[model samples]
Target: MKALVLAAGTGTRLRPVTHTGAKQLVPIANKPVLFYALEAISAAGIANVGIVVEPNADDIKKAVGDGSRFGVDVTYICQEQPLGLAHAVLVSQDFLGSDDFLMYLGDNYVGGGVTSVVEAFRHDRPSARILLTQVPDPTAFGVAELDDTGRVASLEEKPTRPKSDLAVMGVYLFTSEIHEGIREIKPSARGELEITHAIQWLIEQGRDVTATVNTSYWRDTGNVADILEVNRHVLDTTEGPGAAAGEVDPDSTLIGEVHLEEGARIVRSWVEGPVVIGAGTLITDARIGPYTSIAEDCRVSGSAIRSSILLSGSTVDGVSAIADSLIGRHASITTAAAGGDSHRLVLGDHTRIALAG
Candidate 1:
């Protein structure tokens, strides 16, 4: 089987970070979001992969060059316009000819990867397989309504009044019949070929379309909040029991599940985890709290921060407190004021901000 990853969407929500880079290349826990999907596809035992990209999205190509890093050979399929999922499949016909393949969204995070679901689809050989999970607002997502036997009876894209809470996930497994389904569907009201419509078309044809209700974790990291949330989940789930493998001083204190990457140093500081410090980062005389990830080469001195993401090469100096913030790459945040309180920030790349401390 092969894999098809869609990476062409211009992430308007995550600007101006996406202004300089592809949304798929955004890092969570110091690893690119697109890498997670590629690794998952590779873990599912799919070797040959196709990545659908816009003509201008070269960052994806440069970062994932040849896909050998993820143990997969990738073929770049160019989509001239930002159509839609079904349109992407239609354009990738040459690379995906006559092969069953897994379709993954580049920014979606499915906890525990796609190995089990791929194995299930390979055994059952369904015309199409989709994963669904409950979401609070079904109207914000394409939802699946299942029949008594748990087969996908119908699909609605962002319905005003959803029939069920089962929101469709970004991962899918499909046989060659999906190509015909895509061909039979027309552009939606949004002027794009909707994948839900094509899946509904397959169901109407009496094809074996399956739906699996996933109770585990899945998220589309399209915005800052979701990115931080996914980072917390990844760190908490994977980083077992705190380890001070880095150059932490004896005067420092580490609590909970903290993970200090190589060359990271915590000098005369206190860190309460579920926190991860990336390689070469320095935390001196600072208080690092939970649900925070400091990327590589960052510096946080004489500051207190919680529930924030400090991107690579950033610096935070003498801040009283920072909460629920996203400090971008190479950004510098400092406090010159004599007195200050907790602040919430969403700085972009290379930003410089000075607060009154």
Candidate 2:
């Protein structure tokens, strides 16, 4: 079996950041979320992988390369536009060939990984199988209606009135039959060829469609909240190798759960855990704590950073505090503005703000 990872979307929701980088490349605990997916795919024993990317394919290609790093033979398929999920599969037909494959959303995060799912699919070889989870708001997702016997009877894509709370998770198992289904379908009112419609068509044609209720954690990291939530979830389970205090001053007080990467220096600061300070970062006279991922080459001085994911090349100036935020690459946050004593930020577009005085 092969794997197809859809990463073509423009990620409008994560703009400014997405404006410069692919959403899949955004760091969760200083590691790209896309890397996690690739790791999962590799762990599942599927090495031949096809990645569907947008016009900015070079960025993703450069980061993932030939997928050799992740133990997968990678193929990059370009999507002319953000048409839809089914359209992505349609374009990747050549790469996918006749093998049953796993279609994974590049920006989606499944907590337990797809190893077991892949194992089960390989064993049973169903025409198509969908991962489902009971969501509070099924209206936001493609929902599945289960029969009395617990079989998937119908599928609806973001319906006005959901028949079930079971939302279709981003992970999907598909056989070669989906190509024909994609070819036969028409675009939805949204002018996109949705995969949900194709699956419904397969079910209508009596194809052996199965649904597995995902009990483990699964999140589609489309928005900011989901991204942070996934980050927190991943960190909660992550056990670091303790604080690798490289250049810690005697006055500095480092507490539990700090991961100071190589060349990271902490001086006269108090740090509490689950903090992951990236390589070559400097933390001086600062309070770093709980749920902070400071990316490589960052400079933090006399500041407090908590519950945030700071991308590479950012700097937090003296006396500034940031929490519960996603800081973009090369961003600078300072204590004083040009006019007076107010926070100043050289930020990008779609930047969400909840300022603290």
Candidate 3:
């Protein structure tokens, strides 16, 4: 079987960050979220993969290359616009051909990978199979209604009144019969051909459709909170036995599960983990708390940070007590030279602030 990974969507919800970068490229624990999808596809033993991308996304090409690194031979199919899931499949018909394939959203995060689900799809050979997760807000997702026999009975794309809470995940396995369904359904009220509608079309035609509820971790990282949450979960599960490959000064202390990448230096600081410090970052006179990830080439000094992500090249100095925040790349965050009772901040567009001083 082949695979089609959709990476062309414009992440409107993750503004400012998505304005300059692809949402799929957002890092969780210093690893691109798209890489996790590609890794899952490669692990499933599907080597023939087609990635649907924007008209001219060289950044994605540069990051993923030919997919040889991930054990897949990638064919890049350009989607003219950020249409919809069904439209992505329709455009990838040339690359997908007649093969049974998996369609994975490049920005979604599925814990433990999709290997076992792929195996089940291969064995059962359902005409269409969707991965579902019970979400608190079903209105924000394409939801599925399953029968007592576990077959998918109906599907709805972000319905105001959802019949069920089983939100369809970003992954789906489908045979060529889905192509017929995609062609049969009209664009929804949202002006795009949603995959849920196509699957619903198949159900109307009496095709065997099924779903697998992902009891394990699964999140759609379209916003900052979700991204940070996924990052924390990934670090807790994957950081494994800590390896401080980088230099740790005698004055510094590292505790718990901490993985320091090569060239990362810690001086006169204390860092506790489930945390990962990326390559070449320096930590001085800081207290790095658990569930935080500091990306490469960053500097953190005289601060206490917990549960935050500092992107590449960001500097945090003097200002203390940060939590549940995402600092963008090359951004410098510091206090004014003179100490004051009143707080002062130079904020950017879409910047959220809660002063604790």
Model number with the top lDDT: 1
Candidate 1 weakest ten by summed lDDT: 236-245
Candidates, ranked, TM-score: 1, 2, 3
Backbone clash pairs in model 3 (N, Cα, C under 3 Å; residues 3+ apart or in different chains), count? 0
Writing each residue's lDDT as its tens digit, candidate 2 over 181-209 gives 89889999999999999998898998888
Find the 10 residues in a row with the least total lDDT in model 2. 337-346
TM-score of structure candidate 3:
0.94
Per-residue lDDT of candidate 3, residues 164-207 (tens digit): 99999999999999999999989888789899999999999999
Show the colliding residue pairs in model 3: none
In lDDT terms, how accurate is model 1? 0.91
Task: Give each model's whole-structure lDDT.
Answer: 0.91, 0.86, 0.87
Task: Judge candidate 3 at residue 296 and give its lDDT.
Answer: 96
Report how far off residue 65 is in candidate 1 (Å): 2.1
Ten-residue region with minimum lDDT total, candidate 3: 341-350
